[model samples]
Target: MSPKIHFISGLPRSGSTLLAALLRQNPRFHASMSTPVGSLVNRMLEAMSEDNEYSVFISPEQKRAMISGIFSAYYQPQAEKAVIFDTNRLWCSKLSLIKELFPGAKVICCVRNVAWIMDSIERLVRKNSFDVSQLFNNPTERATVYTRTEALSQGGRLVGFAYNALKEAFYSEESERLLLVDYDLLAQNPEKVLSLFYQFLEEEPFQHDFENVQYDEPEFDNRLNLKGLHKVRSKVELQQRQTILPPDLFIQFNGLSFWTTPSNSLANLIVAQPK
Candidate 1:
């Protein structure tokens, strides 16, 4: 049987990494870290330093080979029954490329509230954990505070882009092969989420002890923070009642302004019932 490929995508800190790590625990799954081709292309562009002239120099064939190379290097020869899972946010930005690379791969798009995701990203940057500013900045280190701020503030838009990309991909592809998992729902009912996930993969769910599942705490790179790049939480609201809702309905559905937006104040007016 051909190796099964699974692509997991979502905005940063939306629990994509945690889900990837958990999926890796399954004996038949080989989930790897984020390896976005767009990110690689972005890096290459930065190296070239040709403003507005830099294009995707790598041909489609080369891009496909690069993705195949990642799988062969990391997952090949592991086990025949093992499925390869690439948990990369960069893939979210290049859904078309990903679809071209793994023609029949299962796409898993994770969803989370835009406000919470933005807040989480803020915490990550403040702690100097993972710097995604490189994607939007040249020399990465020279990334302005506004660039960093915009990345977090535009969580809804990012999620929307990913969702729309996946939607378009699925529109022209098989419907049974794509899955969307909500982070909040999974957090509330992991067992239910896992059951649905297993159903999607057509795999038998097994009982495993998760009491000792060791999750590594994210470490902050103090060296990066030493540059006096202090983290500042913005008070900007994400919801402004735009003309069109972002393509990613999940992002907008799950409360548009949880942490930073003033429009979310209306959400607080709703009374919560006792569970």
Candidate 2:
């Protein structure tokens, strides 16, 4: 049976992990910590592109089945009734294919202030002085946080690629298929946020124990020298203080949340029309 599948994507350090952790509370749902399915899809498409040797033999419909088969193959272990959420930043950029392949599938995009996103990553690097994160391929010598942040937010880096991809999808006609999940709302008012998200997915709500949700992949993070990167507290709570990033760095992306600003077409478009 082809299982119901959705997607999780958006900016880095924007609470995707936390959302996944909370969603796993429902036994019928299957969520992974940044799986490589999206990358594989892209590579398969590359292999069948016009420049590839197999381009002549591969039909469009065959390509579709091949890509879809990847999902079916990898997630075959889950119960046929389970709902799957494939996490990947590149999903946003691939919305056209996703819409074509999955029909009514929706994407849950996690979002937060860009500055704070950078700050969170920088804090990770600073807190673990001797190690650099896989965010930059785990370099041996540590770079200045400012330098690192700049490099990461520039083109082709984690933040930049996801940021650009999200903007493209947010502006696309398929925008209705995307639900934006704010980091603050998630941490501060989880039940409400989750309720809204569940409603979007049209699934009956399941009782979630806010006090005891468990999720962690420290072993995975340690490989990146970003130990505890996906660690979530037993309890979800919002921070009561300002970020530790320097004001200049923090302000760089503070007021740039286009999705929340009322006048911004992108912000208002999501709600003005029903999906």
Candidate 3:
């Protein structure tokens, strides 16, 4: 059987990494930490002084070559079930090229509330992964630019962009196979959410332990402190006020809030009580 490919798309710090880590524990699945394709593409763009266009001009032959190389390099041949999960934040931005590479693959969109996502990203900036100097360069230009900050602003604007892109894909002749999973639900009811994921991939659920899933802790030592990062993010949020996202994206991704509600009977079921 041809290897199954699952594309995990979402804002950074929105739990895609956690999901990938959990999925990798299953014997049948082969998942990698965020691959170099995106970073490579970004470097290429910076080198060319152009926006993302590496995949745009690539011929069909080249596209196949690149995808095959990525697969062979990242995926282990011994994986029993042969499902390859590509966890990349920029995959959604390059949906067209990704489709060309893996036509039969299933797209799994992970979403979260914009505010919380921004808060998380702000924390990330404190860790020094992004340059805070970009925030002050040009607010309008920066808003349109794809900084790690813009990716984290999980509110309406980012969701709207993703929604419109997915809508176009689904409506297009090429997209009958995309699935969306809420990040909050996955965190709250991992077993149930993962069961659905397994069913979607047509794989038998493995009897694996979820409690031991290793997740990296958020670190802070970058340019901005928590207070400074939030202040800058607040400024960006103000500039983004007119670009609100659709309500459905929020509804679909806000499952975490619902699961946390007192009356939801399952509230305590999957939640880990603090010691």
Candidate 4:
């Protein structure tokens, strides 16, 4: 039988990596950083769309089965696990498809302040001064913090694309399938967060050691010249830091965390209480 499938999504530079690291601690569960399965699913759909001249020969049932097989094929080795959490930022934009593929599947979105997301990416760029990130196309886009931040926040870029997709999911009809977990809350009080997380997934809780948690993708990071991009610290504790971004630029994302407000959508959200 196929493993119980779920998804991990939300903004970049958030705690998706940490969340996956924690989830994988459960022997019955399989989780990891972003996977190519999402990309493969999209490509498969495109191949069967009107853009392909022969798509008329493919029926809806065939398309659905083929798309569903994408996940099964990629994770055939992990079928023994009771659950599998596929990580991909684009999953946030594809909630409808997820509903059709795995009706019971839920998506956990790891989110943080939009300003902090930008700050985190900026810090990574500065840390790897010797290499140009594939996130940008040319030297001009990586010239300065202003250019870099602006380029990344463009609709099609990494941060912006994820952010927009997350917003779309937040308000979508399938919003109930989403659970937004704030990074700060997850780091500062992991056990509490995990308890609630398990409750949401209706799974038996496993003892996750916050201190010894470990996960990283050095090869993937190296390929993008963004080393440590998905690296999770051994300890799961919130690190307090001042903004590395300019005041004006930082303030631009002031109210972008729409999940903080309960009045907006039906999605469940676990956020830190305001001071």
Candidate-wise lDDT, in order: 0.51, 0.81, 0.53, 0.92
In candidate 4, which residue pairs clash? none
Off by over 4 Å in 3: 39-59, 76-81, 124-175, 217-275
Winner on lDDT (1 vs 4): 4
Clashing pairs in 3: 114-154, 114-155, 156-245
lDDT of 1 by residue, 135-162 (tens): 2434443364334445434434444455
Each model's TM-score? 0.58, 0.92, 0.57, 0.98
- For residues 183-204, could you state the per-residue lDDT of candidate 2 as single tens digits? 8778888888888888889999
**Global Cα lDDT for candidate 1:** 0.51
Worst 10 residues of 1 by lDDT: 264-273
Point out the higher-scoring one by TM-score: 1 or 2. 2
Candidate 3 root-mean-square deviation in Å: 10.7
Look at candidate 4 and tell me the lDDT of residue 90: 98
Of candidates 4 and 3, the better by lDDT? 4
For model 4, the stretches where C-alpha displacement exceeds 4 angstroms are none
Write candidate 4's Cα lDDT for 184-238 as tens digits. 9998999999999999999998899999999999999999999999889999999
2 or 4, greater by lDDT? 4
Stretches of candidate 2 exceeding 4 Å from the true structure: 137-142, 263-275
Model 3 lDDT, residue 244, Cα: 31
